[model samples]
Target: MVDVFLEFMLGPMRAIGDYYFEHQMLFNAIVIGGALYKLASGKKRHEREAENCN
Candidate 1:
């Protein structure tokens, strides 16, 4: 499912992130920030749809 796909994608991505995180904190911050942004955006969209139904 989606989890499996994310795992596949993030596995290598995490390795790359870790590799770069050692040399550059800003890159790590950006990666983490992007993931947080996506999570928040998805949550906000779901909440908006729920509010519309109510």
Candidate 2:
């Protein structure tokens, strides 16, 4: 049932999936770094706001 809906786009989806898997390690590292950077910067901004309020 689901295969019927998914069959038409599977080729391109598989290609994209393959490319990501080929560079999966690098892709994961970049994603983790960006997430950590965002977390640190947001914490800093929140700290500054709290300090300003006090």
Candidate 3:
């Protein structure tokens, strides 16, 4: 049933939400660090590709 499927999906999501609520600062730091890391790596990759094209 749809209820069963929703419970299965939402159960883990609820746990994650609870954890984030309890550890808001840690979670925010992790998210921001991950975004920065991706941005830095993407910039380096673009620079390398540009150098190769030239």
Q: Report lDDT per candidate.
A: 0.84, 0.88, 0.88
CA RMSD per model (angstroms): 11.1, 3.5, 5.2
Number of the top-ranking candidate, with TM-score as the measure: 2
Candidate 1 lDDT over 1-54, as tens digits, reads: 976776788986776656775878777788899999999999999999999999
Q: lDDT: which is higher, 1 or 3?
A: 3
Q: What is the per-residue lDDT of model 2 for residues 1-54, given as tens digits with 9 covering 90 to 100? A: 866555576855876866888999999999999999999999999999999999
What's each prediction's TM-score?
A: 0.52, 0.75, 0.65
If ranked by TM-score, best first, what sequence of candidates would result? 2, 3, 1
Clashing residue pairs, candidate 2? none
As a whole number from 0 to 100, the lDDT of residue 26 in candidate 1 is 78
Tell me how many clashing residue pairs each candidate has: 0, 0, 0
Angstrom error of the Cα, residue 22, model 1: value is 6.6
Highest lDDT: which candidate? 3
Clashing pairs in 3: none
lDDT of 3 by residue, 1-54 (tens): 976776778976777766778999998999999999999999999999999999
